[model samples]
Target: MSKRINSPDTEADITLRTYLDIYPHVCFNMIAGAGSGKTTSLIKALSHIVQNHGAKLKMRGQHVACITYTEIAAREIWDDVGNSPLIDVSTIHSFLWKIIRPFQKDIKDWVIERVGEKIKEREERINRSGTRATTKEKLRKEINKLNRQANAVEKVPFFNYGTGSSYDNGILGHDDIIKMAVSYLNSSEVLRKIIGQKYPYIFVDESQDTFPEIVEALSLVRITNGDRFCLGFFGDPMQKIYPSGIGDLPGDREWKIIKKPENFRCSKEVLDVINNIRRTGDGLEQTQGNKTVGSARIFVLPLVDEQQRTEYLRKVQEKCVSISDDQLWLADGHVKILVLVHRMAAKRLKFPKLFAAMNDNAPLSFKNGLTDGSAWPLAFFLKFVLPLATTKLKGDNTMVMRMLRAHSPRLNKEQLKGTEVRQALEQLKVGLDMLVKQLGDGSQSTVLDVLNTLKNTDMVKLDERLIRYMEGNAEETDELEDDEEGKEALSMQNFFAVPAVEFWGYLKYYNNQSPFATQQGVKGAQFDRVITILDDDEGKHAQFSYDKYFGLKELSTDDSKNVKEGKDYVIPRTRRLFYVSCSRAKKHLVVIYYTADVEKAIMNIKRMKIFPEEQIFKVEDLN
Candidate 1:
């Protein structure tokens, strides 16, 4: 076991020390600010527990449950602390699946009932589409497939279709599992007791962003049995960016709330602007000090004429380039462009072109993105697996190759210098083309047939990561992930029966043409210099109004403010979105307003003294 962590630099660190000193008796909440050292603080807390009380907990058969917000966060914590049986670190889905998996019969029944309702509704819709010659055959096939799925539920009694699979695979789409777990715990007193006996400490990271149902269920467990375990919640209320935030989460007078209000990521200059805009920025200090001097600037662009708008765009591009060349910045400066809308990054900022330029000419290349640890696997499915599994005559080899080069560290341009690997990929491409012909149109071949054909070929390297992508870990595989899972013990026919369009939709989500990302996409990520573009012309901004935050407008007396005080808030999603974007920058932040009356808003903000005079700029000045 590691030694108890001992680093007390700030008041927050001291607060953490005080909480952990009491150990298993206190139910505490850590209220952190944006850019604060929450991750570091969490690591310290975990380390203290592991080094000091881990052995005792293990002796008692009670372990710590550290629940993170996402898989990436879980992996990060696991990497930092190293894997330990005394502690269980995982996302909410993974953690819940373990607790709920034992009650598969109850869950399966619940899932089947839900699926049956959906299938019935779909059948009605298909029938309503009319029996036209063009649509009749397709509708008939769909109905048959749904009927087959419905029938399979009885044969495969322990199945879950909610996770894009025939059974719960301990990965993806955990909403159903969470609901079922809540229901099961509410009904079964024995199961709750069993859980309480096993886990003595429950730590929820990013608790502000936790789902309402999950929070409610956890609170139910605590309230029902108050003396069971110590539950610790840690997150910033300002950072609650999701739809169902911790506003409805269970908390009362007994739970002690501690504040960690130090800005470790940003400088005082950046914090000044942030403090001015933030609703609860009292006593928030930048701990970075003289370490990193950061700058914040707001640019108001002209929208009167086409010529002025064109010039404004030109200046913005120049500034982006200049920011890249600036010495004070760190990392790839070009990667720092943030947009209000995903489309704005592609349309106004030309992010696709920027990425293409970077990949074509830069010293380094961008990596292929992943969503829920399934990017490369899905890409592999689309490229090699799908065509072989389905009756599709042709495959997009170019797109497949692009995904390969982007994501795989071993399959880059540098690695392609050798003729052997290049020839192998080319041979594999040829093998894929020929296999489509061998399978033929309407050929009755399973996914295993494709695997069998390519298993021994010289084109496929046994040691390559592609194998992992093609064949995921059997322990973690479900019906969608591994079609052959159905055939193993259930004796089900055509277990991997995903529709072509349905599969494509999953793949298309991660494989976007542009490099520009949304606020939600770039959370928990930091950049050297961030240039955020604000515009609502695409109609993607929804009901989020920037005018109120920018000081141009006030909260109308008639309008109901959703924001809650202290514990949680029901404020505009736009406020959280802006906070997320602004907090990402380490050294420099440039926010561009692309509205018609941009000058008025800028003047209003200046009058309010939200931004210093030197930090505000006009687009015309840049030109």
Candidate 2:
């Protein structure tokens, strides 16, 4: 524990440490801005709790719960807290499930109630005027499905997460667990009391990204337990980029908002640019923690075709190299080129269909799950195919044999004759040959084609869900869906229909094997130099419009209406996103705007004063 955390130098009412010092009685939200030392403060707070109240909590069988956004983040906090048992660190889903897991009966009941509510909701929607027959039929099917689940849920032995959702098998979906947990916590006082008793002090990292209902439910626990439970949310409204997050937390008179105004990450110049970008939104000024200076520039270029755009990017890179006087600016994988969305990244890297499928209008949570290796086909490719392909290309048959021994079903059988062993090896060899033959030509094959190529081999076992999706949706796959769940399922169907090569590209960018990344995907990650592409036309998402936020484009009629009604989302969302992207640069930042009008866009940007005249560049037509 640092002395700064242990011995504070500020007023008790203003300092975050002082509030934790008044633990159990203190419940608040800590507004830690971009590059703010939020995690460091969190760790220090955990240490203070341990030093001050760890023994008492241990005696009472209670612990401090820190629910983070990702598993990687959880692990980092866990490692920082010395893997302390007193501090329970886990991802949001894991933590929610852990609290709600023991109440199987409640989960079952809640799920049934949830199904009833959905059925009623859909019925009401169908009752509305102008209901189409096709929509009516789809809603009827969804209602029928929910009815079946309501009946079956009562007999379900137990529910499980991180597995395929099955009405018969009692497996729950990712969103369901969160919904179920929050609903139960809201409705059941006993569950809230149990949670408060188990974890007396709960701190949610990236709380802005947490569902508003979860935050509210935790607040319920605090209210129920009174001073016995302390709840703190650590995140910045400016950093809330996810679609489902509680953008700006609703005003709570009970909770004190602690602002950490100093950024411990970015240098002065880089920090100044972000602070300016945030001024129009939150108006929260940030002071640099370090004395180091940085550089920032914005380049405006006329809209061009793919080939010309590529050349323009190269010229911009050359300019970045000149300004920084560092050859590393031109190096691949050294500078992250952040785009507006996955489609932009996919277009840049040559994977249109896969990216589009992933961006389908379903739960963003599921798409996130695919990258977390929860999706079997994706997981199989990363774990089995990529490694085996690399080894086969290297002519390392020994590694192939090793992977075969581990995964090959035929080779695992005992008391097999030499002939049978040879036969198994021959089958695997043939399978590998087929896979290699398809992939070796650098062809972008569909996942279905790859699955078909490997389906006969015993070594390349497929998940039943993947198989079912492939076979089940083969018919009627092109029909549009009216139901939300139907839409999500169709996304998977469309994904499987896309080229396997697109998935390779998807994972390549996902794993940082490629230099281009989506702004939403690179949250909390810093680079020495960052190149952010702000092309709203390429973004293709209706939810966020960077052009409108940056004044390069006019707001739509509905947008202007929403602003007048005080229901606007575009400005706040885009502002937060742009702030996040610009703040990722440690020493240098470059923002390239691909606009329809060079002069008009440049004039609008100059008027905005996000960057001064010299720092902003106007590129000639890249014809």
Candidate 3:
């Protein structure tokens, strides 16, 4: 159940209502902290528009555009609005794609040019490797394959780009779409005017996550028309976790500030803990006065002796288990143990890994696993595609068919039942093995080479739809234009040139059941209790550091220097990530840090009263 509720209008709510009533004439930036009812306020503003200004909007053929940061957010807005055509709710990517897809000819031309450039770059690399007979043969072989792949005279109608799993997606990668959208809006006045007229009132939720370029594009429309269009920027600067983020408010122009400091999620006690971490907190208030006061502590997990550290972690885990007892909170979900790390593959945490084992092989696994918490496409790839592709193992016909059926939307069940399809797959696997073998003994092979061999195979008739899988094309999203046969195949070909082993290794790395989740993945989610494991590990993105947030070090200077000069400066991203992790708990928040000078840092922090001494515990002390 949600901790927040629809109550009487607060000071922030009244201000938002007043500002939105005068929208298009008055631009406002709602600086809402975590769990400040930003979504509810957004919904309320839209509901207001639907009730009061619906007729005017309907007559003018315009709608209020609410652009969210994620698909989940978009859905929540949709559910709240309940099938209102006057309300345009979509993720920034979806909204931007809708605007840019119409100008797809330009995008198509751009993709072909990019592909051509890649081919040229590959050729140059091959040339530079060596002039040996083997090198020449390899180069010639690769060039011929490239020529065959690039043989089509016509344009690429649909190309897969973004990292998402929507099939044969339309032209332009998500980044490209944003860039192209910015370019198109800059050059085309009529289109911008049309868009401005279409969505005169624009509300951007979680505006901090939006790329500056994308924001500028939308801002351009509003700027060109001059107050004829209104854009409400709603987000918390403290929660700006993305590295590329430029903070929540619009950089293009100034606006009236509206602060929503009432945190409806966590209790005042929890807020106090969050506030202490960031000196700039807005002193947010809890929604319910009777809400339970959650415990917040910082545990210093010292890495004293290399061997003893393992035992220390075991004790720490056991203590965490006791702290996260199920009887303590009424929340239904399992306690989330958040491990802050530089990289999932680079840093090792045992708890989450222990539970990673699951047989994702059955036919219904992909579908069921989605509801049960596995990423659909990745799970499908791991269970079906990767296993079969890596080995010459047979009798996995259903897995191939299921994967092909999923990725290739046009492939019917009857198509999978065909004996020719099975024979082709069997032959394809054999051919793949031979290709890998030929590249033998210290020779490296690219993902593209493997995919290309499948594309060129002759044993079984290949469906153009299933060709993407054979080709290791992941970007073939659902937005791709259908061929004369009305079929689409989304491919991840951009990942093709990557070394096959490395690609598989990354997947193997991802195929884990660790209870620990990166702070970014679980930011919006709430847990009964959260155990955040912080460490200063090498290869971790320097942007997120616990030392800076814990008041052990300054947030600026070194981190800022590292970013600007590309030197060994502290990571600035850690600030927001730490802030986000601290705020994710509804009941208890435990921060465990492993630092180099742990004893000194702990002593300094305790002396400075950074955290309550009673709440702070040493790893050994817990035992």
Candidate 4:
């Protein structure tokens, strides 16, 4: 049974189709609000292209490219499009890589240039920091490692994508692929023509978070190719979360901004709050597509300790159940409690110290790596060590052998009789045994111990970034405040041991497999009832101060200056995140604020007018 309504064409669908009817493609940006059937609209657009231009595209050997943000989203679009031969659906990374991967020589040159820039950055860091031998030694290895790769790029036969970088093997990392593609597209008119010819029409979902450089490059393609190539962006700028994204469309007079002002997901109450919060920024109001009843409020609380926070969460669930008249809100996994950081949920999951060690007050980029299994050490464990160790411990030799055969390097199945292949297989098994002995118990083994065993066994080749971190070198992120000194690498010894089983729970939370999710993680996700827990003290990042955002405290001196200069980042970003969190509720939304000044917060809540006075409640009332 399809949940999609067999409704008539929305003005957006009609407008887009009418434009598609034209000969030369007119690139336009669609402002699709949350729960507004953005994907449905995108799917319709894809179908329209196939129906209208399918024959011509097939004749020219061209295809419609649908670029999605997440692999999950890409798969959904792929399936939704019926796996059409004339249409290609892939993630932004995969899509860009596909178009640009053929230019091996260009890739080599780009990578070398990029690595040289990194080397320069590292040398400058060493010059700034004086006389720290351990740090200098680590930097030396990094410099050497990078120099080797840069010098070795030309000898590589062909570059590959989707895998982490191995300069020796010609595989590029995620950032490298995207950055190289963007760079090539910007620099080469010939490349742009080739891309436009190959992908006559391209649609990028979640375009708000697409890198600004990529957005501009695509816009250039659209402009240069003029009617030959059409590019469509389907996203809401108000929902943008990452600081690095292009929140708004390129300010070009030629580009059209098509507004999809419909909300089919949130109920009337939820819609009202979203519209109000949004009005403070761009002031685009959403018309509720569903006429269902719902509740939304800004719940106020004084700064709370761990125990109080636990009790408050329970009470909020109870409140949601009573208010929404849905008993399911109390049901496990039925409601969502979105915190501002992984550490908050990590505390509840009993890995607070481990999470805190790596993540507390860390830049968002660093935290993203650890939580999402992108950071090298974490990736090593989850991808290589854990699967083999667990299968061995369970005595699942079939699974173990299969994993070993699948992942062990230099295993050529066709040449199984060869001594080299046989030795590699035996070595992998030995390595797996050593790994299981060291960390299988999930106790007393430091991260460094597990890493060394994995590296020694060649279970998997560690990423260069991981090598740098292990060498007491942490990569700096964009969010590093200007005044702060360079961050110290997280202590490998003090960081929690690989309790693999417990780590799954943490990973699940990151993937939104658990009821507890971070606010940013649930960008395109919604639930029946949602409780967004916000605390300035607990968030610990200088970037997001919900207190300053909601007028509980004054904006920092720089924040005010940024606003005056029309370069404000904090307030607008906070507003966008707040809007995103609040908009994710179908029946109810409880935005809990742990603030120092309840009176001021309450007063500001009234001024904001996003919530009804009666709906807002204190923690004591929840009791």
Candidate 5:
């Protein structure tokens, strides 16, 4: 009674066929690069289950459980499987939470009992006298420390603090989701049965990004149900860009490894560049032939001082403007600009200008940041305060207070008033509270009034442009439509549209940490161009070790001695980092330095040999 579809003539089709032929409660790991039809393969496999196996077993259904790392990805899969009679897809977090929420008491009791014992030990350290530490302070420190340790150990890998109960429920974050899912699978027979009845085919998209806990959870589902459930994982090992993602996949024995390395997203020239960089090592060689080809180039800018930096950025801006205008007539072809920083200071200094044009637009379509970095306090104000000003309680003090509390949760109301950030926070909080109260009370005109007020402010004007630009984008509209089903499935707004204000505010105060602070934040993300600003300061270079550079092919070995010896041996880790940064760009790679030290830059090029001298661009020389 399930609908079936024929496999198209694509790599996904070939991969799915191999999966069907074996059909052994199977785990197939399909490695494919971005835009290389990995999702298509997943779809094909799900369709095959509907056609070949649906109705053969009583428990099995056509519903395909598709898991991804981020909400964005989950939405994408939902869109792909939209209204399909034969399939149902969701992010693993959303899926597990849905099943577990009904059993909240059970889960809460289990987690609290376990975590409570640890909390008690920490509480004991503080004297019973109300003198030692407050309950919130104690809880905050202990929870943050436990979460960090859990993430470090890979036991609890993904934890986001913002958004909702799923992230901030004190028991579940990204890593906790996996642990809880695995625990549920181990203990709950009825739950397993329900999941089995709902979904027989488990297709984990971006499997390379999945941690061991997730794998264990999926494995349990398969084991509990036996032949009724089939597990299919799709990802490219080479593209396992996150540090935690390295060597995460099960070996060939436990799972069938299917290689799908056709380069569908890039040009031949681009593929060549990737291959050339990848082939420099001994153990690492191109397995799947490069099927993608495109024009790839590296642009190196010599670092001088602040003056030179400004001039360099100006020139780059001009180039971007030119490209944007030109691309209006042609396909923009996924242009991304990656600005790599050796330190936090460089990132703060360089990123504002690089993204100024886009950020200035209405409905701000472009976002820039370090992988897993903290949200900017200023950005939060821009997003939340203006909207809030439109409400009945339109006092500047309330707006500032809300903004402060939202951005910095560690401070209490008393502390909020005393702190230097007090004035700003008060204004923002008052404005926001007014806006929310007015909106909730159905005061549309009041909301418009706040908007008018904000229109006069600098932040409000920027947000207005951002709003306008967002409304004008056809692609965003399409993506919004595609994500509608996923939004409904998650019973939330499109995750991306969940206002950066609320999201970042929740993260800052409740979560008290940035998800970007970890490795998982940057996974599956890229830029059309990249600018790496290396810190030549002492002790910083040590951070660029082989282990730190897992995204590049060169970091697979111990070559620290060669690098230290100054034998012109590029630090494999540094090279890999450079490679990862460069690869993030779909078109161009830009390197910016400020030391006037062309020696280091020259040495790097000679050692890595990633690009010729002609490809390097001197920013000072540019018109």
Candidate 6:
């Protein structure tokens, strides 16, 4: 039942096999490029262990712990394990939560007692007696704004009930899961023995992106558990796209590093381009064969001022249309576009225009109870707002009911006035309390069904023609799929039409907006095509030195510094940033520039050799 496929006859295969041969007792690193079947190899290795070594291993019912960065990636790996009899895979965070949940009371008590004094101080500062409403509002707004800003920049919300303030606290986010696990291993020899007896093998995927903390944790496990556990770390340093990625190869005691120099996801031409960028004196050769099925071209755009940036965006839209008509169109119409700004200033300036363009072209459409924007807001609300509201309402069901009534037209105009809203909200509160109590007693589903049946009596369908005209002629479809248990978790009908409490949960907990405000928000995410609009300011050049502006102070040294100081300092970073942006496009790259700055951008483009001089264009020349 293993879903793993055999490795193809290539350098990648040879490299993977070498690691598996020495695995279990030994630690080996397989640095394979993106789309190089690293996950496939891990699955195959796990299958081998399960089928051949399960009895010999006698792993005390311990499952293979496969750690990944995202929930989506973890699910993908779980699928790859494919109904395997022996293997167990999960995200590191989920795995830690499972292990720690048993000791939750002790852990919670310890953390709360330790951090109690700090929390008390903060609460007292804001909730002083006789405080003016304006003062309280200002403080609350400040707290909310700071929390939002932190979420945007760090992808970490202000509060983590598990670890306190994520901002001031030095707690690791996802990576800390492994760190905590390692701490448990070190603290309890019995726990280590239990884990060692249960799961004999550990596979860490995407090792290149792993942090030093995770690496250290794994090392501790190996040292403490002796030879009972086997570790396999797989990743490619060249594909270390994350800023804090630990690109170290395996070395020294109990560690072996193996190179996987294969170009399976790109054609020879594409490999050539990749090699040129990665070329150092290291003599790392690019492997050919297993070529990708498409062609790739890099482009550069010149923008002398804001006017030029606008025109460039227009050109990008035109290119998207062309690419859609020709090649690289997907069923979902999700184009992976990357707009790389060279400096912090450029990102600040250009990102707004870029976002506006995307919004103008693809206005966000949300479910009725959800926020008007994307799903991310709903996810946030579910995580923070729902619990707080539930606690405040004190078993009242009226919160959700009032929202439903507001949207419903069952009541007459006068009846829909202020007092009615308040009374209806009160009813909703009571109803929610009853629903929660019934659910706690295992009658919640029955109550939910009864409530839905009653609410449907007043349901009315509005004319679709007007909605279509106002929101564009887009087809409506259910967003959630039916699970095997037949439990309706989320549905378009309930989510889009019914203003239920469940809908609020869907909006608050499922939103996936980009964490950063500008281009950084879209980092690590890909689009089909990209259009970049450069700001027409002195700071525009800073976009090229992303490391400097984005707090990568370590990388923004020497040459990057000189580039910032020199007259043409901006050109190199700008051109490089543009290349990074354009390279993110899977199919097409379009550049737009002002008629005046066309020559300057073209000269930089020619110098960088992104495209031939003939391809460079001016605004007037386009027609």
TM-score of 6: 0.56
Residue pair clashes in candidate 2:
445-500
lDDT for predicted candidate 6 compared with the true structure: 0.46
Give the alpha carbon lDDT tens digit for every residue of 559-621 in model 5: 556566643233433444444444444444444443334555555655655555655554544
For each candidate in the order shown, give its overall lDDT on alpha carbons.
0.58, 0.78, 0.60, 0.76, 0.47, 0.46
| Clash numbers, per candidate | 1, 1, 31, 0, 49, 34
lDDT of 4 by residue, 1-623 (tens): 12232355688988988887777667788998888888888888888888788999999999998989877788887777778999899888888888887777778888788778878877877788573776666666667767876778868888887334556568776767777888888888998888888988989999999998888888888867888888889999998988878898766666677899999999999999999999988888889898888888778999878898888878877877676678887888878888887777787776665575456554333455665666444666667666677779899988987776676554556746657777877887787777776764455665667677667776666766566666654443212232011222433324434443455555565556678887887887888789898898988867788987887777888988888898746789888988888888997888899999898889888888989999889876786
TM-score of each: 0.69, 0.91, 0.70, 0.85, 0.58, 0.56
Q: Which candidate number has the best lDDT?
A: 2
Q: Which candidate has the top score in TM-score? A: 2
lDDT head-to-head 2 vs 6, winner: 2
Q: What TM-score does model 1 achieve against the real structure?
A: 0.69
Q: Clashing residue pairs in candidate 1, if any? A: 562-570
lDDT of 5: 0.47
The weakest ten consecutive residues by lDDT in model 3 span 480-489
Determine which window of 10 residues in candidate 4 has minimal summed lDDT.
Answer: 477-486
Candidate 3: where are CA atoms >4 Å away? 1-8, 109-153, 157-170, 248-254, 280-290, 304-314, 320-333, 342-514, 548-572
Residue ranges of candidate 6 with Cα displaced over 4 Å: 1-9, 18-24, 57-59, 113-189, 280-283, 290-294, 304-310, 316-335, 340-377, 380-623
Tens-place lDDT per residue, model 2, 1-623, is 34434433223223766777774577888887877777777877787788888989999999999999988989988888777889999988899899888888877777777778888988997899998998777677777777777788888888887533555457777778887888788888988899899998999999889988888888899889988788988888898887778877788787888888887678888898999898898899988876777788988887888787788888988887776688887887788999887767777777788666755664454567555555544667778877887788789999989987887767876846769988888888988887776665477677777777667787666777667677773233233355445665777777778876666676677678888988887888898889999887777777788777767667888888888998746877788889999999888898998888778887888888888678888775222
Cα miss at 301, model 6 (Å)? 2.5
What lDDT does candidate 6 reach at residue 604? 56
- How many pairs in model 2 have backbone atoms within 3 A of each other, for residues 3 or more apart or on separate chains, i.e. clashes? 1
lDDT (Cα, tens digit) per residue for candidate 1, span 1-623: 32223444567767766777673466778878777777767777777787788888878888888999877788888777767778899888778888877776776677667557656754665577454654545444544555665666656745432332333322224456666677877777777777777877788999888877777677666665566567778887667776666732355776778788777677666777666656433334444432687678878765445356556655765664575466433233344666664444433432333222212221110112223323332445556555443433445556655644554444555656767686757665665565564454454544444444455443343323334334543322223211222122121122222222333333333454223456656777777667776654442454455665565555553334444223322224566777777888777777776665767877876786767977677765675
Model 2 residue 5 distance off true place after TM-score fit, in angstroms: 9.0
